[model samples]
Target: MLATGLTFVAMNGIVRHLGTGLPAAENAFLRFAFGLPLFLPTLIPALRRGFPRDLWAGFALRGALHCLGVIGWFYAMAHISLAEVTAIGYVNPVLVTIGAALLMGERLSWRRMVAIGVALVGMLIVLRPGLRALGSGHLAQLCAAAMFAASYLIAKRLVERTSPAVAVAMMTATVTLALAPIAAAVWVPPEPWHYRWLLLAAGMGSLGHYFMARAFAVAPMTVTQPVTFLQLIWASLLGTIVFGDQVDLFVILGGGLMIGAVSYITWREAARRSPITPPIDVAKGA
Candidate 1:
């Protein structure tokens, strides 16, 4: 999870860099196009096995959700500070947790409820309503976060039934196909340097999603979600170092609160799963 967070932050940084003059749809299409090579071997075998109608539908839905997220993320990163984008992206985990409870029938304890409440407060602290008018970037990021959460949850379930490689390959292929028309409509031919950056972004995203799928396959969402907060820290640093963006104290504080809430929720979850020690059977021991 930590590695996934680091790679995702790096990818997002590259995305922001490449987003400067490129339309978001084109940037998104380019990402999947470049990443396609990594999945060709796996995708080929998966397709040879015969693409069932249901499988195709599932992949299409997943791809559409991811495509929406990629477009929003690209647009937001181009217009807003990376830290702001990352902070807003934190909402993904919150949505995932709720979705798990409501849709997947996962248990949601009062402890988790309190944690979520704290996280919501953190979001308010970061956004600080009325202090500044909300912009397109913030709205885009919010939409991206929600779509990403839904996509991730679907991927997690799909991973249980399919190989991670196949799941990722299908998503990549579908998203690439879905974005083609939109990208063509707004396409501005990119410079060689832009392709280089975007290609690297695609590589990082491919690696990140592979690890993410494997993680979800091995663990429940509750077990893996908290570690994502690390991305916010990495993004804040990247924004400052790479883009010369200023770090606002309020954002840090809010992020800290969210991290704290996630940590407590994780701890509670772990405690629940720990083996109970049987009372010492001193009376029975001879």
Candidate 2:
């Protein structure tokens, strides 16, 4: 999970570094397109064994949803501070928990409900709609979070029936195809530097997804989700040091609150040996 967070933050930093040089859809498409090769070894073997027909719909759905999320995320990175993007993204886990309960029939305990409520409050603090004008970037991230949550919930189900490698590969392929038309509609030729940076971003993104899938294979999303909040700290430092973006105190405070709430649930689950929330093995390397 720690590896997942670091790799993803590194990818986000690269995307931020690229700024708006390329259209959001094109950038997202290329990220996955370049990363597609990384999964070929896994994909080839899975293809030889014959892809399961039953799982096609699930993969397609996850791919489309993830593509939308990535487009929004790329747009958000260009328009907002890295810390703000990460802070707003904290809502993903909360949305995931709700989806897990409603769609996957996971139990929703009172503690979890309370924790989720607190996390929502933290999100509100970060947005502060009335106090500050909500920009397109903020709204984009909110939509991205919802899409990501749905994609992750579908991934949780898919991983049960397929290897993580195949899941990641198929998702990459599908998203690349899905983004092709959107990217072409507003396509702008990228410079050589753009390709190089996006390639690096692609590698980081592939690694992040692999690490996340491995984590999911061994533990429930709730167990692994909170650990990702650590990225907020990394993103804050990176934004401040590298980008010279001013750190918003509200973002930090709200992110800290959300992290605390989720961390509390993780701790309580481990302490009580809750059936709904299983114990995680951090050393297990997911």
Candidate 3:
């Protein structure tokens, strides 16, 4: 989990470094496109076996939603401070809980409701509407979180019918295909240096996902989920030291609240032996 947090933060730092030189769609396309090669080993076998035809629509839908989320995340990286983006993203697990109840028919207990409410309050603290202006970047992150949550709910269903590798490979391929035309429509010729950084970002993103999966496999979500809070701390420090972004106390406090709420939800689900809400790693869109 620590490695997962570090690699993801490093990937975000690279995206922040890239800024808005390329369109967000193009940037998102290139990141996934470059990462696609890393999955070829898994993709080849999965292709040879052939995918279950019934699951194609699910994969396509998930790809489209995740593609949009990636575009929004890239745009947010360019527009907002890393700390703000990271803090806002902590709301994803909460969003996933709501999505699971609405779309998957999961029961919403009173305790879960309270946790969700706390998460909403935490989110409002970070955004602080009325007290301060909300920018497009802030709105984009919130939308991205919803898209990511929806994608995750779909993934839970798909995973029941297929292997994790096949699911992941198909998602990467579908998202790459989905992003291509959008990238081309708004394409800007990237500098040679952009390719180098984006490739590195792709590598780090893949590594982060791999580490997160491993962490989940070895430890319970209840144990692993809380450790992810370190990511906000890392993001805050990195934003301040490297990018000169101001360290907002409200962002930190709110993020902590959200993380606490998420951790409680995970513990409850684990204790009940119900369908555990997917971890916030979906925020990384593995």
Candidate 4:
């Protein structure tokens, strides 16, 4: 999980560096372009044997939604401090818990509700939108989180019917193809320096995803979800050391409440569900 966090931070650094020159949509497309080759090795096996039509649809929808989320996220990352963006992004899990209850008809317990409420309080601490109010960077982070939550909910449905590897590969392929035309329309000649940052962005993204895939393979959702929360800590550290970003007391307090809330929700979910083997939860950026 720590590896995942760092790679993603590295990815943000690369994106922030590159977005100064290129369009965000184009940068994201380059990421998928570089990433496309990586998928073929895993995709061939999944293709020899096919999944149901419904599963394919699920894969497509999840990928499309997530691609938009990534666009929003990359745009946000380009403008914000790592900690500020990431602190706001932690709300994705809370969004996921609510999505599960509403869309998937999962049972909602009072504990989960309270946890979400507390987490909201944490978010308010981080945002403080009223006095010395919200800025564009912060708004972008919040939007990214909301969009990512939508993707995860769609993904939960997809994973139930297909392997995570196949699902991931297919989604990457679909979104890559989806972005090709847009990238072509806005394509600009790239500088040598731009390619370096773009390479780092793409590499970190691919590597971060690889670790995330491995983390999911090893543990169930109940186990892995909490591990992913370590992002906030790493984000803060990176922000301070690398960029000299300020540490807000609200961030610590709010993030603590949010993490505690998510932990509570996960615990309640584990207690309610059967002990049968199931796929792990895959959390991503807001």
The local distance difference test score of model 3 is 0.81
Model 3: how far residue 139 lies from native, Å:
1.2
lDDT of 1 by residue, 128-150 (tens): 87998889999999999999999
Which scores greater on lDDT, model 2 or model 4? 2
Please give the lDDT score at residue 261 for candidate 4. 80
Question: lDDT tens digits, residues 55-146, model 3?
Answer: 88899999999999999999999999999999888777667667767776767778778877997898899999999999989989988988
lDDT of each: 0.87, 0.90, 0.81, 0.72
Pairs that clash in candidate 4:
144-286
Expressed as tens digits, the lDDT of each residue in 48-81 for candidate 2 is: 8875677888999999999999999999999999
What is the number of backbone collisions in each predicted candidate, taken in the order shown? 0, 0, 0, 1
Runs of candidate 2 with Cα error greater than 4 angstroms are 275-286
TM-score of 1: 0.93
Consecutive 10-residue window with the lowest summed lDDT within model 3 = 277-286
Per-residue CA lDDT of model 4 for 158-235, tens digit only, reads 655555566667777877877778768888878888777776677787777667555545444334545567778877
Ranking by lDDT: 2, 1, 3, 4
What residue runs in model 1 are displaced by over 4 Å at the alpha carbon?
275-286
TM-scores, all candidates, are 0.93, 0.95, 0.85, 0.83
Task: State how far residue 110 of model 1 sits from its true place (Å).
Answer: 1.2
Candidate 2 residue 262 C-alpha distance from true site, Å? 1.0
